[model samples]
Target chain A: MILHSIGWDDILQATLATLAMLGGSLFFTVLLGLPLGILLFLTGRTQLLDQTFAYGLLSVVLNTIRSVPFIILLILLMPVTVLLTGTSLGVRGVIPPLVIGTAPFFARLVETALREVDRGVIEATQAMGGSVSQIVFRALLPEALPGLIASVTVTAVVLVDYTAMSGAIGGGGLGDLAIRYGYQRFKTDVMIVTVVLLILLVQILQAFGNRLVIHFTRK
Target chain B: MNSQPSQPIVSLRGVSKDFLVGGRAATALRDINLDIQRGEIFSIIGSSGAGKSTLVRLINLLERPTAGEIAFKGKPITLVKGEELRTIRRSIGMVFQHFNLLSAKTVAENVAFPLKLSGVRSSSVIAERVSKLLARVGLQDHVAKYPKQLSGGQKQRVGIARALALQPDVLLCDEATSALDPQTTRSVLKLLAEINRDLGITIVLITHEMDVVRQISHRVAVLDHGQIVEHGRVEDVFLHPSHSKTRELVHEAEPENDELNLGSIPRGQIYRLTFVGKRAHTPILGTVAREFGIDYVITGGRVGTIRDVPYAQLTISFTDGNVHGAIARLRASGVSAEHLNGANSEAPLKATAT
Candidate 1:
C-alpha cells in the first residue's frame, strides 16, 4: 500500500521543513514590509512626510516588484537565493525568495491599511500638538491596527502558496515532499493528505487573523 | 457673555488667506483685522464659503495667513516654529465640527491624548486630569467606552473634555455644535458657556448659525465673501443688523411668518419698534397710545433678553389716525422705531436714533 511507503518520519520531516520556511520567511517579510509600508504611507501625497520624488521612486520600485508573477520571481531569484542562504535546494534557500516575493505584496497591503486611517483623526492628533513621530505611533498605527492584522493574515496565506511553488524549484517543504513522493511516485494518498493539510493551515491562519482583528477593532 | 474690557488674547492684523484652487487664486479671507478679547466668547458667523472657518483657523495658526500678522497674547504666532509653535498651539485647544475623537481610544484615553502629547508622563496625573475634564463636560460614566459607542452629543463631550485637558487659555471651536441636533447643540453651548464662566477660557467659535451666536456669544463678527462686513456686541448685532447678509442670517434664526396681519384696520403706517434696556420692560406702547391720543394695534413681535440685556421688536399698525407723534414719544423713551411699510423694499425706514 502507498501508506507503507510514506512513513511517519517522512511526513514529520516535510511538516517541519514547511513550518521552518513559512515561519522564517514570514518574520523577515513583516520586518521588512512594515517599515517599507510606513515609508510608503508617509511619503504619499498630502501625507505628513509627503515628498513627491521619494513617493514616486518608492511607488515605482514597489510596483515593479509586484508586477512579476511569484513563480518567475522564485526562479529568477535562485542565484541571489543561493548566495544568501549558501544553498539553493533546501528550507533556508526557499526563505529568501519567499520573503522577497511577499515583502512588497505585504508592504503594498500595509500602505493601503495605513491610508484607511481617517485624515480627521490625524488632523485631530496634529491639533493636539502631537509631533509627527508621536502621531504615527500613537494615533495612525493604533487606528490602523485591525486592518494591518488582516493584511498580515492575507500575506501569510499567500506566503504559504508561494512556499509551495518554491518547492517546484527544489525548495524542500510539504510541496516538495508531495511532488517528489505523490506526483512522481504516483502516491495518491500522500497528495490528498498534503492538500488537506495545506487547506487546514490556511483555515487556521485566517481564523486567527480574524480573531486578532476583532480583538483590536474598536469601531 | 463676557463683557469685561480685558486685554485682547488674539489679534489679527490685515490677515489674508488665498488658496490656489485648480491653478486659480481664490481668497478665503481678505485683510481681516480682528481682536478676540481675553475671557470673551467671540463668534464669527457667516454663510458657507464666507471664510469664517479660515478666520478661526488663522487665530491658532492652523491656516497661515497669505500675508499679514497674527498675534496671541501679543506674541507673533506667524513667526514661531517647532517647539515654540507647538507650545503656543498647546495653549489653544481646538474642537472640530465632527468631534474627531480617536475611535480606537476609550473615552478616558481620548481625553488624555493631548496630555500625553504634551508629554505628561505620570499616569496618575493623566488619569486625574482626564476624569476632571470628563466630569466637567458631564461624561464621567463613559470613560472606558470607545467613541463609536457614544452618541453625537457624547462624542462632542469627549472632544470638549479632550480640548480642556491641558487647561488651555483659548478654545477654538470650528462649527463644533453644527453636527449635533438642536437639543444637543443647546446642551453643548450651555456647557461651553459654563466653561467660559467658570474657567475664564476665551472661546472663539465660528458658525453659520446665527442662533448659536445669539445664544451664548458675547461679541459677534459677520463675515461675507472673505471679509468682515460687521462686528459688534451680540445684542447689538442681533437687534440691528447693518449688513444684508447679517439681516438674512438673523431672519433665518427666527421662525418665518406667513402673513403680516394689519389687525383688520384701514390703511395705516406699520411701525417696527425696537425697545432696548429698561424700555423693553416698560409699557411704552400703552404710554404712547394714551399720551398722544393715538389708537394702535399690535400686529407681531418678538421680545427676548440678548446678552442679558432686555430687547424687543414689535410691529404695530396705527388705527384711526397718524401716530408720528407717538413715534416721537416712543423715541423720547429710548425706543427706536422703523416704519415697516416699506420693509419688503430695499429702502425700509432706518431705526430712529435714540
Candidate 2:
C-alpha cells in the first residue's frame, strides 16, 4: 500500500493495452478458427466431404503450431509477425503471434464442440435433404452453440495467459508493467495488481460464458 | 401424371450393405429383395444386430447399398447424389429410435426444419404446416417447448410430425417405439396406425418386437443375420411362421405358448390347435370333446388379432378317449392340429396347417 515506482496512470495504460490485445486477438482467432474448425470437422474421417489427404495435412500443420510453446512461438514468429503487422513489439505487434498461437488451439476446441452435436440429429437433417452447408449452418452450428461458446471462453482465458507471456519480448501490456516496474524495478505492488486484474478478467469471461451456455442449452 | 395404386411405393432388389469395421468389410445386409406396397404398414422385425436398422436406412438412402438397386416409386435411387438425392429424400421421411429431434429448436421449429430446408420461403406457410403437423401428432400444445422439455413419447411425436412435414409418400421408422414404455409404445403405434389410415402413407418400420408387428403392420418380414428369412401377411406369418427365426420371434411375443411346464402334467397326447379367422371364435375344442367323449385340458394358449384378423393358438392335451379322432374332427372343422410328440418342452413347435 506504500508509494511505489508504478503510478495509477501506468496501471491504467497497461490495463488498456491488455484489453486491446485481448479483443483484437480474440476476434481474429474466431474469424479464422471457426471455418478452420468446420473444415477440420467436415473433412474428418467418416464425416461429410471427407478427404483423408487434406485432413492429414491440416492436422499436421495445426498440431505443429499447437505443440510449440507460446514463449518460443513468440520468438519464432517475430519475422512473420513483423511482416503481418509491421512490427513485433507492443500491443499491435503482439496480436499477430497471439492469434497464430491460439487459433489452432481454438480451432481444435471448435472441432470437438461440433463433434459433440448428436450424430442422429445430423443424420435426420441429412435425411431431410439438408446439403452440407445447410447441415453445418442450421443443424451442426446451432446445436453446438453452447459448446462453441464454452470453447471460446476457454480460448479467451488461454489468450489472456499468452498475452502475458508476450510481455517477455517487449509486448506492451500489464505483464510488461509488472516485469518492468514490479520485477526489474522491485515494485511488488504493480505485480500484485496485474495478477489480480488477470484473474478478474478470466473470472468475468468464465462467468459470462457459463451464462450464455446455460441460456442456449435446451438439454 | 398417372398414379398407379398397384405399384409398390418403394422397392429393393438384391440390395446389400457392406461396412468396413476395423478395415474388414462386414456385410450388414445381403440380397434383400422387398417391395413395400402402397398404403400398407410393413414391418421388418429382427433381433439386435440382425441389420434391421441398416435395412430401413437403405430405403431412405441414408446408408447406401453396396450392391443392387433401390427404387422409389419406380425410379432407381441408389446411385443418385447431391441435389437429386436430397430431392428424393424430401419425399421419404424417417423417424429414429432416439427421436433425433433437434435439441436446439422448439417443437414447431423442428417440425418446420424439413419445410424450411426444402426452400419454403414464407415463414407463415412454414408455421401453418408445422402447426398442422403438430396437431396431427397431438403435440400442438407443446409447440413452443424444446425437445428436452418434452417426454420421450412427446419427443417422438415431434419426430413423427417433422417426418410428415413434407407429406412424404413413405415413412421409415427405425425402431421408433423401442425406447418408449409399453403404454407410450401403444399410443405411438396407434398414432402410426392412424397416420397410415388417414394419410395413406406407406409405413416401413423396423423393430425387434414381434408384438409391434402384430399390432399395426399389415405385412411383416423377419430378418436374421442380414437375411430376410421370412416375409408375408401378418396373420399368415403369426399363425404359421415358416422360418425358424420367425418362429423364435413369434415365440418371444407369445412366451406362454411355449413355456408350459409339461413335466407336471400326466401322460397324454398333446396337440396344438390353431384357429384362424371365423374358426377362432368357434368352440371347436369343446364341441369335439363333447362328441368324442374326450376330456381335453388346455395347457397354454393365446387369443389375439394380427392386424384385425382374429386368431387363436391353444395347446391342449387329451385326458381320455379318441385323441386321434378328436384331432381329425378338429381338422375337419378347419382348425389345424399338430400332434406334439413327447413332453420335450424345448422342441420347436411344428406347424401342420390344413
Candidate with top DockQ is 2
Q: What is the lDDT of residue B67 in candidate 1?
A: 96
lDDT of 1 by residue, B216-305 (tens): 998899999999998888877777777889889988888534225544556677777888889888887887788788877777778777
**Residue B6 CA error for candidate 2 (Å)?**
2.1
Docking class of 2: high
Off by over 4 Å in 2: B1-5, B257-270, B288-295, B317-334, B338-354
User: Model 1: residues >4 Å from true position, as ranges?
Assistant: B1-6, B256-265, B319-324, B340-354
Candidate 1 Cα RMSD after full superposition onto the native fold (Å): 2.7
lDDT (tens digit, per residue) of candidate 2 on B190-305: 99999999999999989999999999998889999999998877877887787889889988988764525677776688777899889988888788888899986788888888
DockQ of each: 0.76, 0.82
In candidate 1 chain B, where is summed lDDT lowest over 10 consecutive residues?
Answer: B345-354
Best by TM-score: 1
Model 1's alpha-carbon lDDT is: 0.86
